[model samples]
Structures are given as structure tokens and as C-alpha cells.
Target: MSPRPDTAARQQPSPSSPPSDRVRRFTRAERWVHRTTAALMGVCVATAACLYLPEFAELVGRRDLVVRLHEWAGLLLPLPLLAGLASRALRADLGRLNRFGPHDGTWLREALRGRRGPAGKFNAGQKIYASWLAGATLVMLGTGLVMWFTHLTPLMWRTSATFVHDWLALTLGVVLAGHIGMALRDPESRTGLRTGTVDRAWAEREHELWRP
Candidate 1:
């Protein structure tokens, strides 16, 4: 007599089945917004460098063109994020970024010791970075607008705005460089952003609280 058919089916894995090792991490819309924001921010940062660095300014020439490009790029920096709010998942995730659980503090403590604890989709460090970037972008936008409309403002105010804008841009550039460096060093994290899926084992090890 043949072994039970149901038992046989349960024993054999399907050859054409999708890989079970991968789990969806980011939605397509999330990835789209992330890429768009990064591209726009990159343009803003590059133009800023060209405008500020004497060597780059001389090499690039067309100071006025670079200034205009930088201003426009800065103004557009928040658009991708605003558009992403249309996605329910993105909206929900934004809320998640705002809330800090006991586990988050634990994660930070572990981080200080060169270790990490089980964290949710966004770790404590990432949440802090996202929050900081959101505020920084708004501040940049406000100062940028004031500088762009310098003719409408008092000369002193315009000068102040320019000072604030320049310093903020420099700080943001440094922070963004660190962000890029960390992303480059973590292939699994990078893969999640690019492919919207992370290896199940990788996710479990890095973000134990996250469930597929």
C-alpha cells in the first residue's frame, strides 16, 4: 500500500515555490519616496558644496546657476515625504517613529555597549535620525525661503538667515555622510531599502521584534 498522499505532499517542498528566506520590509511606495527624497537631497547638497567651497565654486563657475539650483532643490526636498503620506503604511510608520517604547531605551543602552537588543522595524537610532532630519529640513526650508526672498526682508534679517542656512546645511551634510557610511556598511539594511525585502534570518537577528 502507498504511503498516505497527504503525508507525501507534506514531506516534499515545492521546487517552484518562492524563497521563504525573504520577508517584505518596505512597501513599493516607501522605497519610491526614499529614493526620490535621497536624489533631491543629493542635488541640494552637491549644489550647496559648489556654492560654498572656493575651489569647487571656481571649478564649477556659474555661481548664480548653482545658487538657484540649490534653492529649488532645498524647497523640493520635502515634497517626496509629503507625497509619501498618501500611503497608509507610510503614514502608520511615521506614527511608529514618534513613539518610544521601553525596548527603545533598552536598545540604546545596548548600543552604547557595542551591542544591540531586539528592536522593531525602526531601531531607536533610526527613529532619532528620522525625527532630527524632519525638523532640520523644515528649518532649512524656512531659512532658505528667507534667504531667497532677501529683498523683502531687512538686511540684518537676511544676513541672519544666511548664517543660519549655511551652518545648518553644513551640519546636515556631515550627518548625511554618516548615514550613508552606515548604510554602506550594512548590506542587509541597504537591501531592504533597494529591494523592499530583507532576508528572514537577517531581520530576525537585527530586528527581533519585527514580524513578517
Candidate 2:
């Protein structure tokens, strides 16, 4: 025999080992909820824009039809968000997001200067956005329902609800535009949100404190 079967040469150790210390930031279900909400929000916003824009109104004529579509979209908007909130893990993450400390302030200061800061799991801005979106969505849903069911409210209340609903929609649209721009600004972040996984380097660089 050329060599004994049990006498093969041993291999040397490799420079790098497999990652065994990383933590799971988002579960599969949580990711699914996030993605679904994002998709629905995109469609709703686009449809609302088409209905609102004077030039595009001809394509989606009939005020009743536009109102019905908007109402349905608004009704569906909170499902994913509420589902995600049902997970205990996600609720804990929300708690972490709400916590504001010295680090968060420092991160905001640096962010304002056009530099990346040491953001933990989430920066101050992200936390604020999450909170704002939560409140805005609730407001939108309540006001939207009042507008949709005009028979349940007095004429003046319905008019006020209509004003609140429209203004909140406009505000949320602008905020979402900023959110999308920020997501696009960082390829790794965008990838993470899309795939629910990110490279170790990305986590370390952007959220060092988050890695276990």
C-alpha cells in the first residue's frame, strides 16, 4: 500500500474559525412581520399619493372609490405591527429602544455632525422614530375609522377627524421618506433589514454593543 489507512497526515489549524458567539437579534416571525408591514406601508403610501396628486386623480377618479381604497389600506396597516408587538422578544427589543442613556445622546451628537456614532442596538433617532410611528399609527387608525363611519359621529366631529387624518397622513409620509433615505444610505443596514442577517463586521462597526 502507498500509505497505511490510519497514518494520513494531519491538517494544520486554519487562521479563522466559524462564528459561534453571535446573537440572534430578530426571530423569523419578527422579521416576517417587519417585512409585511413595510410592504403594506409602501403600497398604501403610493396609492394615497396617486389619489391625492391632482395630475394623477384622473387615473383614480371617483371620490368614493378612493376613500374606500384608503380606508381598506388603513385598516390593514396595523395588523403586522400589532402582530410583531405580540412577540415577547420583540417587546423586549422595544423596551431597549425606549431606553435613553448617555450613549444615545452621544450618538445623536455625532450623527448630527455627519459621522457614525457608537449606536447600541438602536440609536436615539431610530428609537424616536419607532415611538413616533407607533403613536401616529394609532392616531391614524382612530381618526380614519371616525372618518369612514361618518354616521357614528356628529358633522363637526367628522370634519375635525377628516382634518386630523389628512394631516397625520402627510406627516407620516414625510417621516417615512426620511426613513427610506436613511435605510438606502447604508447598504449593510438595508441588507440586514431585507435578509434579517448581517455580517459580523457590520454589526461590530455599527452596533458593537449589540453583539454578544
Error of 2 at 78 (Å): 1.6
- lDDT tens per residue, model 1, 1-212: 88899999987867644268888888989999999999999999999989889999989999989988898888888999899999998998898899899999999999999997869988999999999999999999998889888778898888898899899999999999999999998999999899888899988999999776
lDDT of 2 by residue, 47-154 (tens): 778777887777767867776777787789888867788788778887888898888888899989988887888878999999999899889889878877888899
Q: Which candidate is the best by TM-score?
A: 1
Q: Distance from true position, residue 125, model 2, in Å? A: 1.1
Note the Cα lDDT for every prediction shown. 0.90, 0.78
Candidate 1, number of clashes: 0
User: Which residue ranges in model 1 land beyond 4 Å of their true spot?
Assistant: 1-18
CA RMSD per model (angstroms): 3.5, 5.2
Q: What is the TM-score of each candidate against the true structure?
A: 0.90, 0.83
